[model samples]
Target: MNSASVISVVGPTGTGKSALALSLAEILDGEIVNADSMQFYRGMDIGTAKVSVAERRGIAHHLLDILDVTEEASVSDFQRQARQAIAEIQGRGKRAILVGGSGLYVRAVLDVLEFPGTDPRIRQRLEVEAEAHGMAELRARLQRVDPASAERVADDRRVIRALEVHEVTGKPFSSFMPVREYIQPTVQIGLDIPRPVLHERLSTRVNQMVDQGLADEVERLDQRGLRTGKTAGRALGYAQFLRVLDGEATVAAAAEETIIATRQFARRQSTWFRADPRIRWLDPREDDVVDQAAALCL
Candidate 1:
């Protein structure tokens, strides 16, 4: 492996990626660059399970809390920032450890991914059409233009972006998808845990967050324009708890919903990361998992 190669710790949520990344950084004299999209927003800490300053153990971490809740995060911008951070870390003679469960964001840093540029006029036109015609209409249009992306994209935001890409660049959005090929020397370590174990862990973690005043945290952020945040407002716990604030649900109900949503999200994450052949899988339950991962990096 190249000495300056990036070490990426990736997996589903509640799989101990952060803990392993911390251990790897300590052992390899590394700095951490966050790839989790949710962790980018300030005041999103408790819900995102952001590692605290004390928990970081003085390890320099880049790209956490860099955006306000109201601002949307762009994968293209993050790719630039993360690569710059990695280069700076390498230039200082320290390894750069990339950590997070956000699969697309991770790939944006490690893989040969190209993001399509957006034109606001085109996006606004699409948005208006969707509102006037409905998502079913828009989805049908997308199917006509880009069958692959239409099949893959489910959300309103991405569907519009796909149409916008087709309009502006006259190319399918799927064409810009990341290839498995790495852009640089990299070793990706994926934590493998049983589905049953992961589900239980996610449930327990969500409950713990509730006990730790996740509602209060959400309330504080809500006062800070969190509701206006297109990305952060829709996060796993934050969205559910936002209902609590609206009197549409109780805290317990929100926690239960968050647990179910998180488990589903984790399943999607597992599917995404498992598709990548480059990642070396380690059962985090193993006694010598850290040693095994360190050996791969070395």
Candidate 2:
């Protein structure tokens, strides 16, 4: 493989993406660029399943733990940083491996996606409309105008962004769907796990997180202003645990809800990535996953 080739390992959260990426980096003399949005926060290690220093096996990793819990993650910002990291790694004659299950973040790094400049007036107007009509109504309007964008972006913030883009550019947000092309020389590998097994694994993973003091982690972050952060406050496990802190639910109940939400998220990720034909799918249970992916890279 050329030194400039970028390899991305993507799948659901519990699919062992980090392990595969570690192996690939060791074999390919690569450095990792993280694409998981949640892992951007510095102290969100346990909930996001960030690989520990020991697990990284001394491979240089970039873009992990760069954001505070109170900061909103911007895909556009991440795109810039990730591209720079890739260039730097490849410039050093090493491989650049992008690893995560965040579908849009992955595309932001690899695809020819342009982040449009926002108009404050348009954004303000959309915020007012969302406040007056509600997020569901605003999302419904976006569904009519840009169904493709509406399908993937369900958050109020992202829906507002889509509408703002449409108003500013006079183009449907869906018109920006990434072409089946890469901005850089790249190969993508996806893990294929059965739904039943994935769901069970997700549940077990959530249980493990709880055992690893997820509640305490959330408590620490909450005290550190996580509640004020628009994006981080709504993260899957942290949000559920916040309810636990409020006495609205038990930690057990929170874990169950997190499991369900993670399963749904995995389904969405699967759908998003399956639509891309360039990704080479492999069964994670297979012993030769690293070899299979390395063959594609080389």
Candidate 2, run of 10 with poorest lDDT: 172-181
Question: Which numbered prediction scores highest in TM-score against the true structure?
Answer: 1
| 62-137: candidate 1 lDDT, tens digit per residue | 9999999999999999999999999999999999999999999999999888888889998999899888988999
The C-alpha local distance difference test score for the whole of candidate 1 amounts to 0.95
What is the TM-score (0 to 1) of candidate 2?
A: 0.94
User: Which stretches of candidate 1 lie above 4 Å from their native place?
Assistant: none
Candidate achieving the largest lDDT: 1
RMSD of each: 0.8, 1.7
**lDDT of each structure?**
0.95, 0.91
Error of 2 at 161 (Å): 0.8
Clashing residue pairs in candidate 2 (N, C-alpha, C atoms within 3 angstroms): none
Q: Model 2: how large is the Cα RMSD against the reference? A: 1.7
